[model samples]
Target: MSTLSLPPRLLMGPGPINCYPRVLSAMATQLVGQYDPVMTGYMNEVMALYRRVFNTSNQHTVLIDGTSRAGIEAVLVSALEPGDCVLVPVFGRFGHLLAEICERAGAKVHTIEVPWGEVFDPQQIEEAVQRVRPKLLAIVQGDTSTTMLQPLAQLGEICRRYDVIFYSDATASIGGNAFDTDTWQLDAVSIGLQKCLGGPSGSAPITLSPRYVELVRKRHHVEAGIKDSHHHGASGSRIQSNYFDIPMILDYWGEERLNHHTEAASMLFCARECAITLLDEGKDAVIARHKLAGDAMLAGIQALGLQPFGNLQHKMNNVVGVTIPHDVDGEAIRHTLLHRFNIEIGTSFGPLKGKIWRIGTMGYNARQDAVLHTLQSLETVLRQQRGPITGTPGAGVDAALAVYDENRQ
Candidate 1:
């Protein structure tokens, strides 16, 4: 086999951005047996670390071994029994994903949709909840496909008033945006490390409120293969999927030391380091950094005389969508930026396909230097493709620098 050599790409796409160096290094550390004290110590520390990262005292915070979607599935499957009603407000592609997962888990899914770029108002959701009487309210905090951040601050109270459980998948907007798991009164929340945690996409961090914990524990079933004399079964239905059983996963992480699956040791180390890096830098400081980079990117795109997609007031701080000019070939521009400039941006999904381009400022790449470099490179490629510039030459870079300068003062 040939040596594995790849270009040093600057990932300005929506996710799977460049990971922090410390996280990569942490993954390379020597591994111990799964039951070793050192291994369990790291696991306990990771759970504690993510409690702070998620801004909750849920006491059941843990990492799911697969990608971000695994966290979403685990939460939905564990909470929803057959014929449970769930109301999903669809703003973009991932909202459909939540609804789909609920359906697969045998829920009677009810949905309300706005256009792709806009989000629901709290009153609209309240009306639906009153009419449908769903057992759960499922939503996504940020949908990277449309670069929109749904306003979730009010929905929790609506769910509480109706005795419906509140849950959100914050995979795309956790560290880069304002997410207060406790202050917002969310019963359950799930996130991945790849976006704003400055890590890869193999691990998911999840938190559950005491109310949610009591709900899942009702369906608890210890795997027969691993059950010992002290194990006791609950009267509720046994969870269908062994791997996604939250109670079993909790037992492994809890003082019981029950075995579910062989832990992904490397990914655990990576998850721990991601949380440590974010906490050490301070959560508020990291969010401000993402905001600065996102603001600069927006200013730069506007300076290029290109209109952005969606409502600016509700956009996320980590990604933006730019409208493709009718006269230019969007794919050709992306091709040139990738092959010639060693940069990577994102494309849209579903109804937005071929209509817009998505660019991201997230995690380790959320910095002034990365913003300026991507702006200048995109400006060069656009000028080359369309011929004859519109406004001042190098206006993109200059406008972005002005944003940084203003923030400095």
Candidate 2:
């Protein structure tokens, strides 16, 4: 059999983008025993590192050993008891995902939705919260399917007013966007490293407020295999999923070091390096970089006479959705870019499937060179296709360069 080989494609898609070199290197470091002093020390460091990443002082911050969605599930399932009410505002695909997860967790789910390209206003969410009076207000801070960012600063205060636990999945927007876990009064937040942390998708960094901790801990049950004299069960109903029991996971991560599952050491290293890299660069600097690259990509697409999907004002700083031209075959264009240029962009889901292309400037791919290369290559593919499509030669690259130039000055 031939050796495993894959093309070195430039990932400019919605996520699972290029991992930072340092993160890749970190993952290659040899593993130690799960409970080794060195491994536990790294685990502690990861907890400490993610506190800064999440911008919270909450002692419950830790890593979930799965993708972004696993983090979402762990937070929701642990927090919501059977028949508890949850309010979810849907503006994009991930919003639907939040609602579905809530339903699966046996929560009575209430939903408020807007058009796919538009986000719900704070008042609309507030009105729903006022009417539904949910036990938990769950939402997505950034939904890549529509490339829209829901404004969260106000909703936090609204949840606080109604005495509702505010939980958000910032998987798509955390590192590249402005997320303040403490200032926003968020009760629980989960994020993946792939998007803007410049790492592969496996480890999820999550934070829980003291309020959230107290709520979930009531349902805590020590695994029978690891139960001991000091362990005690809570009065609340036991959490349904064994793997997602946050309280048990917290004990494993906490000073108690009670065994949960074998820690994913390589992923732990990757998460650590991702966080260290971001902090070294500085959070604001990394955000600014994403914003600059995203702006350039936006300018490039518009200069090529492409209309962007969604409300530009509410668009996330890391990804943009371009409306597929009436005459252009979106898939064919994507095919040429992937095969010929070895560069990848994203297609949308749900309401936007085949209607818009999602181009991302995120993590390690969020750079001027990557943006320009994508624009120039896309211009080539568009021009080669036969149709009513028309754009001034080099206009896309020129426009992007102008954005960089202006930023430099």
Give each model's clash number. Answer: 0, 0
- Runs of candidate 1 with Cα error greater than 4 angstroms are 220-222, 225-235, 387-389
* Candidate 2 residue pairs in backbone clash: none
Q: Write the per-residue lDDT of candidate 2 for residues 227-319, one digit (tens) a residue.
A: 432323455566889899888899899988988899999999999999999999999999999999999999999998889999999999999
TM-score of 2: 0.97
TM-score of each: 0.97, 0.97
Write down the lDDT of every candidate, Cα atoms only. 0.91, 0.92
Per-residue lDDT tens digits of candidate 1, residues 1-409? 9999999999998988999999999999998999999999999999999999999988999998999999999999998888999999999999999999999999999999999889899999999999999999999999999999999999989999999999999999999999999989999999998999999998889999999988888774646565432323454566678888888888889998888899999999999999999999999999999999999999999988988899999999999999988888889888888999999999899999988999999999999999999999999998888733456988988998999999999
Candidate 2 residue spans exceeding 4 A from truth = 220-222, 225-235, 387-389
What value of lDDT does candidate 2 attain over all alpha carbons?
0.92
